[model samples]
Target: MKWSEISIHTTNEAVEPISNILHEAGASGVVIEDPEELSKEREQVFGEIYQLNPDDYPEEGVIVKAYLPVTSFLGETVDEIKEAINSLVTFNIDIGHNKVTISEVNEEEWATAWKKYYHPVKISEKFTIVPTWETYEKVSSDELIIELDPGMAFGTGTHPTTVMCIQALERTVKAGESVIDVGTGSGVLSIAAALLGAKDVRAFDLDEVAVNSAKLNIELNKVHDVVEVSQNNLLNDVKGTVDVIVANILSEIILLFVEDAFNLVKPGGYFITSGIIQPKKQEVKSALLEAGFEIFETLTMEDWVSFIAKRP
Candidate 1:
């Protein structure tokens, strides 16, 4: 089978939303090539080596890529994707150049392209994300490992938004506590909560593709018994309050459901929000506060932000 690659040149602020647009269009997974990765210094914990090539990343801004099967409706799909991305400007997101290009590739190339960009990385002090295809040894007795396949879902669970969410989960999730993960995507956060000793976890995603992928990843991580994956809109039709609520989606979408999240979290429980760019941090912070949440902690990585708010 043949595949077509859709590459978008945009700013870091637009990465998460544009990736979602691509995924909704049936892209298997998205790849982010940020020039920052080439120049930034990283702590080489666990002797993990990062082999980066300047040629593979954009010189400025970010280049987001995704693969779509060569289908009869490919043109229409691309048009819709472009329109969706362009519409993000209304949210005050800086899209930068927004240049898009498409190219054909062999099935083998599409299948293996993700391997070139994803590797095992220790995203937090306790949680490390390893690709399903890689071999990684545990560095400590308490270290947690999350295995993901970018080809099967979203990007490797190492995006800053995901990293922050997992780190927040590590800080907030207690043993046997219940967790609700909204827009669970590949179910990475749900798996993390389960690994952190969450006895009952409910994972929801509106997209059926994301629901299936989350189910696969949850089972792959051996957390299916603790985490239940389902198809549902954010917090809607969700009954009962949980000890923790984590949502790693765009801040705008996060705003739409702040009240629901506040109401669904038990008193003194936590609500973790990520996938927020720097510019929108204050807006989300205000919304959470308005919904009667006390901000407990704020986490930032690169140009992204995550908030850990407590219901008092």
Candidate 2:
């Protein structure tokens, strides 16, 4: 079978939203080729470091690749994807070059080729994200390993936005506490909260695909017992307050539910928000404050920003 590869040359800031656009367009998965991967510093304490090929990456910005089966409506799907990505500019997100191109390839080539890009990486002090395909051995007694496949939806949980949220979970999630992970994606954050000893974890995503993908990863991590996966629009049907509420979605979406988050967090509990670009950090912070959350800690990686706000 043949598949069309849609490649977009864009900035790192746009990777999350663009990948989401492609996923919504029926792409099963995405391949990110960022030049920074060639020079990234990895801590060898968790496990082996997989070597990256420089040729696969763009010299500037990032390349997001997704495969769509060859079909008669392929052209229209591609056009819609391009439009969706371009629309991100209205949210104050920089789209960079935004050069999009398409090429045809054999299914055999991409079916398992994208797996090579994922490996065990220690994203935070206590959490290391290991792909389900890889075998890893923990080097410390207190290390937490999260196994994920990211099958057909979400990411490998190594994106800076995700890493920051996991780190925040480590700092805030206490044993027996309850957690609500908004826009759970592949359910990585919910799993982390469970592993960190949260007794009850709830994961919600509007996309049914993401809900299923997260359910698989949650079970893979053996946290299904503690985490409940469901399909819901951000806090719309949510009831009861949780000890910690973490969201790693676009900042614009985060802004929409600030008051909901505030109302759903127990006193002195935390609200962790990521997937925020530098330009919109102040805007989100302002919203959180307006919702009555006290700014706790702000985490920054590359050009992304994450905020840990506490309800006083």
Candidate 3:
């Protein structure tokens, strides 16, 4: 079925509010692009990046992309869809054939599309992550199986940053140890830690959907008892110290919570951190060291780096 692509332009500050308004007005989903997500060079190279500076665009700054199923809604009439969009935002709607294309996709086909990038990922000698739809012919029975379905939130074991965090968790966590996963998206690393013998694992995320999804995943792995998923921001509501703390978030966030993360770990406890781009590795390392952590090991994968440190 053909789809209608609705691009809404607003201010960076107004993106979320405008997206919500559009959603309430019957838009299926809204994709918000933050200028910060792109570098200056990337913004210039890829015209896809929308600049939100008031001086640049003046009135229309933030741009949101929404796809409406033509066959499902708006009566497949350009005028109807245009009227619906105009009701939400003022825009010059460009009607073009093939502006939206329909392609046949099945479960097998969809699985294959991601398979070229997703593969059997070994988090540790005793643990491996395999996509729910993929078969792991080489995995030994001794290894723990982590069936991951990376739907929306970040962790999928496909990204180097995620895999590095998993490996660090496997090497650090011990049986009967208490663990905390900050910014626990998809609960992949937290669940993996629980499977690796962590006695009690607590995970927190900023997104409520992520919390719900993580709970579902925890149940899927039969780790409900060991893993506790909650909607929180970096242990703000979580109290007490843990034996190991795993945070697979951006370098800036890591730096922001470096002290808090350090305090969360008991003396000699481990802190495993990823989501650090190569350029920011040193910065993260310095932050951890400044927070009174002793650097243990650093692992690099692709453009990301994972660091392991110990309190005291």
Candidate 4:
């Protein structure tokens, strides 16, 4: 079968939204080619392979590639994808050179090609994300491993936003406590919560693809017995209170549910928010403060930010 590979040249700040745009436009999965990943430092103890070839990445901006079946409306679909990506400017996301290129390829080529980019990454001190196809040994007695096949729903648990969320969970999740993971793409965060000793972990995502991917990953990591994955828009229909609520979504979306998150968290519970660009840190911080959450810690990685706030 023939596939139309759509490649977009954009910046790191716009990778998440652009990837989502491609997925919404019928992309089965995406390949993110960022030059930074080529030079990223890895812990040798994890036995991570770093034999990266330079030709796969762009020199300046990041390249996001997605495959779609070459249907009759292929041109129209590509145009719509471009339009949707352009819409991110309204969110103040830097799109860089939004040049898009298309090519013809076959499924077998992409099937193994994309898998080479993912490896076992120690995202936090306690949590290490291992691709289901790779084998990793636990480096420490207390180290926790999460095996995942992210598929096309994103959330590999290696992105800075996700890394920060899991790190916060490591510090905050208590034994037998409950956790709510909003926008639980691939169920990575929810699974991490369960592994951290949370007895009850409820994960929600508006995208059905994400819900399904999360379920697969949850079971793959053997956390399905503890974490429950479902499809829902934000915090709607959520009842009772949890000890911790974690969300690694865009800051603009985080603003939408800060109040709802506060109400859903019990007193002394925590709200951990990431997927925030550095520029929007103040805006998210203000929203949490206005919602009566006492700011506990602010975590920053690269140009991204994550906040941990306690309900007093």
Candidate 5:
């Protein structure tokens, strides 16, 4: 089947809104790309890797690419899709034929695609993250199982940073303690905390999509009563101090919000941080010290580090 690849370029600030407009205009799926996320070198590398036939990569603020089968009729005309996209910002639109052929993908094949990348990930001696699509018959019944099928969401416990955070959670969070997970991608840590005997757990993310995804994951784990997933920035909207806090965000954002994180934790509460690149460990440690936190322990995995610190 022939497919039309509609490419639209606009500023990063306008990409999401424009993508929404195009979707409303009858595009099945919109691929949003942030220009800042891709450099010239990256684009060239991507083109070479995909062996793109058209061999064109846009260099602009932000780009939204959509593919629709020619036979599939859009509720709106091509001109209407173009005009709606243009209204979002100053953009350039290009239409091309997709050299890539389409094929039918069944549920079993789609499930295998994700399962291939996931394995029986052992977070600690007592905890293991098992993808729902795969069996964990080798795992002992005494171990805690976190059944997850993270589809397009952040947390799968496979990422080094996520594993580091999970390890930290296992070691630090105690029974009956209140926990708050900031930027709780996939709610893995939060759900794990609940499973580990956290009395009260609340998770929040800046992305609504992530929040919704986390809600689904929370339900999947059957921890809805203990873990509450919501949309919030850090702990700005949360009230009172939590016994423990977990944050798995970039080092820069972690440093920026260190003080706020400190304020959200109880005086003797612990704060666990991950997503620190190897080169930025000292910088993050310095920020933690400056925030009046005493570093307790640090775990490093594949150049990523997770730090456990206590607010004094």
Candidate 6:
């Protein structure tokens, strides 16, 4: 079989929405190459890495590449994808170069190429996010494994923000507790909560496609019974207080409905929020505080941040 590799050149601010577009187009496993990574410095004591080639990345902006099966309607699909991307202009997103390129590759090579980017990663002490194809053994007797495959709304849930959410779940989710996961892209946090022993987990997303994708993932992780996936705009219309409220969404979205979040959380309950860039840390913290939340813990990984707060 043959595959079409679609690569889009866009700005960092547009990466999330464009990646979501590719997933909605049936393209699987996006690879993002940002020019910023090539020059960033890292500690060598904790990391041993090989040299990166400069030619593979765009000099500016970002490149989001994905693989789709070649079909007779391939051109039409590409056209639809382009149209959808252009639609982002209505949202006032700066698309940068917005140059798109397509190439053909055999299935064998495409599979091998993307697999090289994924591996079993222990994102937290108790939870490890493992690719569906990778075999991983639990080093600890109580270690939890989350089997994820790329090609959904997001990649195999190892992004720093997602990682911190899972780690926060490990520390805050009490057995038999109830949790509401807002903007549950790929349902990673909801699944983590269920796996951590949440009795009833409500996973909500505004996008219908994201809601369905998260439902499939919830089932994939065998937490369908405990985690219920629904299409919702933030926490509006949700009833009954929960023990924990987890959301791995944009910082701006978190700020918009934080008051609703506070109202839905019971006294002494916890709220875990992520998908926050470094610069927005103080702003989100101030919002939570204004909503009468006691800031409990703030976790940072790389350039992202996550926060856990307690409802007074």
- Top lDDT prediction, candidate number: 1
Off by over 4 Å in 3: 1-119, 135-138, 152-155
- Rank all candidate structures by their lDDT, best first, as comma-separated numbers: 1, 2, 4, 6, 5, 3
Write the residue-wise lDDT of candidate 5 on 148-171 in tens digits. 765535336655677778778888
How big is the positional error of residue 186 in model 6, measured in Å on the Cα after superposition?
1.3
Q: Which parts of model 1 have CA positions greater than 4 angstroms off?
A: 44-47
Candidate with better lDDT, 2 vs 3: 2
Residues 1-312 of candidate 4: C-alpha lDDT, one tens digit per residue: 778889999999998888778777877667889898778776664435678889989999899988888999999999999999899999999999999999988889856767878888887878888888887888889999988875646646677888889989988999999999998877888989999899999999898877887888887888889998888999997899999999988889999999999999999999999999989999999999999999999998878999999999
Q: All models: lDDT? A: 0.91, 0.90, 0.67, 0.87, 0.69, 0.84
Pitting candidate 3 against candidate 5, the one with the higher TM-score is 5
Write down the TM-score of every candidate: 0.97, 0.95, 0.65, 0.94, 0.66, 0.83
Which candidate would rank higher by lDDT, 1 or 6?
A: 1
**Clash count, one per candidate:** 0, 0, 1, 0, 0, 0
Q: Residue-wise lDDT of candidate 2 within 1-312, one digit each (tens)?
A: 789989999999999999889888988778899998788776665334666778888889999998898999999999999999999999888899999999998978868868878888888888888887888998689999999875547587888899889989988999999999999988899999999999999999999988888888887888889999999999997999899999999999999999999999999999999999998989999999999999999998888999999999
Residue pairs that clash (backbone atoms under 3 angstroms), model 2: none
Best by TM-score: 1
Residue pairs in collision within model 6: none
Candidate 3 lDDT, 87-200, residue by residue in tens: 433322122221222233444443333333344566555666776777776445677887876543333554557677877887889899999999886788888889889999
lDDT of 3: 0.67
Tens-place lDDT digits, model 1, residues 1-312:
899999999998888889889988998799999999877777765325677889999889999999999999999999999999999989889999999999999999998986788887888889888888889999899999999987678767888898899989999999999999999988899999999999999999999999999999988999989999999999987899999999999888999999999999999999999999888899999999999999999999898999999999
TM-score of 3: 0.65
Error of 2 at 145 (Å): 1.5
